[model samples]
Target: MIIFGTALLAVCHLLGIFLGDLLGQALGVKTNVGGVGIAMLLLIFARIYMQRRNMLPKLTELGVEYWGALYIPVVVAMAAQQDMVSALRGGPVALLSAIAAVAVCACVIAVINRTERPQAQTDGAPILHDNPLLTEAE
Candidate 1:
């Protein structure tokens, strides 16, 4: 089972790389970055879909939990990019702009949350099975 799963993952990765290369060529982007970005997006969507369908147990059975911790190193490496950090270290204008943008986003989120109506809930509800959107769709 582990061998089969590994083979399937390798195939999916190869497919992602091929598709990303084609996409990058069309968009004039570097193949390495585009391929990686595409693969990351595919993984994210797969995770979301699996979670929505309650496939966590299956993932755990496959020992996928260990692989989940691999993202920490990638995140740390991105934070270490000198050029990206330098670009953000401009004069007061850049600092103020970032602050203003964050403040605006916060205010917008707060206003939206305040104006939205709360959902109706029964006295006893199963947290896992209860979703307002799913009920409405039914």
Candidate 2:
């Protein structure tokens, strides 16, 4: 059932919050850092594990996918809540870290592209259609 998927998400979210809190305490921060990100990662791994073990039901998967679709917008909304001005005023550390993170992500993407097998080249011919409307006016 869809409720099962929601239950899984809630469980992961709780664990993520706990871990984030622990990490924050370790780093001497007062807030839960990366809790949402950790929860999303947990959700991904959980989905993958369930699929591999043939445990994910159609309804549950649909519920998970529905939430996944909202993930980006939700993240954007959360990020919008952050104090960008304060972060900038804090120092160049935030800026530098952001740049470094982007650079590392780019490099990783390039490496993955290089290592991935190339797809077979397709024929250049345009497909012919029986419908005259889909065909070019002769």
Best by lDDT: 2
Off by over 4 Å in 2: 119-138
Which consecutive 10 residues in model 1 have the weakest lDDT in total? 63-72
| Tens-digit per-residue lDDT, 47-120, candidate 2 | 99999999999999988887866775887676856857666786998888878988999999999999999899
Query: Could you give the C-alpha RMSD of every candidate to the true structure, in order shown?
Result: 10.3, 4.1
Evaluate model 1: give its TM-score: 0.40
**Winning candidate number (TM-score):** 2
* Runs off by more than 4 Å, candidate 1: 1-12, 55-62, 71-138
lDDT for every model?
A: 0.61, 0.85
Residue 52 miss distance in model 1 (angstroms) = 2.0
lDDT by residue for model 1 over 1-138, one digit each (tens)?
A: 344334434454566688878887888887544554555456556656766987645644263333334543664477447435775777777678768978999999999999999998779756687779998996
How much lDDT does candidate 2 score? 0.85
Q: RMSD in Å for candidate 2, one decimal?
A: 4.1
